[model samples]
Target: MNNVKSLNKWANAHTYLPVDLLRMALGVFLFMKGVYFFSNIQYLVDLLTPIDKIDRIGAGMFLIHYIAPAHLIGGILIFFGLLTRWAIISQLPILICAIIINFMGQMHHQNLLLAILTLAVCIFFLIYGSGKNSADYFFKMQK
Candidate 1:
């Protein structure tokens, strides 16, 4: 089908070396962060407490329960360059919410910085996709 060809073409699109490296680095960082969250779930919940207060009841709870897993999965997919664009798309909302929540009240500079960086990288991936060096390209080649 033409749609399949179009998809393959998109997936095989060339990317600058620097951009690919940046994407890989961001994926690694996010994957590590997800692992850290799993190990320190209570700590993550504690950090979200302030955001819940700023927003509504159970908002922080919802983010931790739902978004955390998505973050972890998205990180894995992005890291492997499997469905990278969709993975980034899924993470965009979480990153935006993180920025907003972390930016409010007595801000932690480090958290804000991390959130901003993640958001920037997510945006980049959303626009540019995985690139020629990715598993996406390999899969497309097989098709």
Candidate 2:
């Protein structure tokens, strides 16, 4: 059908290299940050404790235990442009929470700025998707 062809065309559209580079950089940063948390998990737990009390959903332990691994896997997915949109969506909550916590808590201004920049990058990827250099592009070419 014509609709299917149109969809395929859109999927296979070329993207800017800079966008892909940005995606990879953000992914690497998130992956590294997640890895860092494992070495200093108590810090994450401390950050989430007040949020847990406010949300009352018992998310303190959950966020500490699960968010880092999710960030690691999601970052890899974004880096490779494998299921890129889903990966970005999955990570958005954690990033948003970080932004909120940074603002609400007494963290340094630099941390808040970094969270904002990271969130902006996530928004960009969400809107534009993985660029030409991605695995998605390679796979699309094969189709």
Candidate 3:
């Protein structure tokens, strides 16, 4: 009886806010990228122009895999509050490079906005974390 009560207490306490907020924010960014991909493939192609010299076909294929799917998966993980820290860590490099690309390409204000927002949120997740509301907690629970 006491064990049941303790378990219930743990479950009740599982509900928290920070993780939800991060999840929502991450979802928005991911959704935005998918929208952007479908709407402005040409713009992305232009932004990715630098890689063209390496191998045009390969660059296109790489972008299709790297840029499009990553956002989708990242968003999903965040939405489900699973592996969120790892998700953020995985996403940081792409986003940071995007910011660099935009700055170099002189893209514009909006181009920088998502990058900045993603970087800020990822940094927060890296620090304070999502507490017990993530797969990160599951791993820690084992230890």
The regions of model 2 sitting more than 4 angstroms off are 1-14, 52-57
Evaluated with TM-score, which candidate comes out highest? Answer: 2
Which has the higher lDDT value, candidate number 1 or candidate number 3? 1
Query: Residue 124 error for model 1, in Å?
Result: 0.9
lDDT for each residue of candidate 3 in 53-102, tens digit (9 for 90 to 100): 53545657576567766777877776665776677777887888888878
Model 2: lDDT equals: 0.79
Off by over 4 Å in 3: 1-19, 38-40, 50-57, 133-143
Give all candidates' CA lDDT scores: 0.76, 0.79, 0.68
Q: State TM-scores per candidate.
A: 0.81, 0.84, 0.69
Candidate 3 TM-score over all chains jointly? 0.69
Worst 10 residues of 3 by lDDT: 3-12
Task: Using TM-score, rank the candidates from best to worst.
Answer: 2, 1, 3
Across residues 1-143, which tens digit of lDDT does each residue of candidate 2 receive? Answer: 67645543564575667767889998898899889888889877777755646447665667777788988998899889888888988888988888888767677688789888988999877767787788877897799
lDDT of 1 at 43: 73
**Superposition error at 64 for model 3 (Å):** 2.9
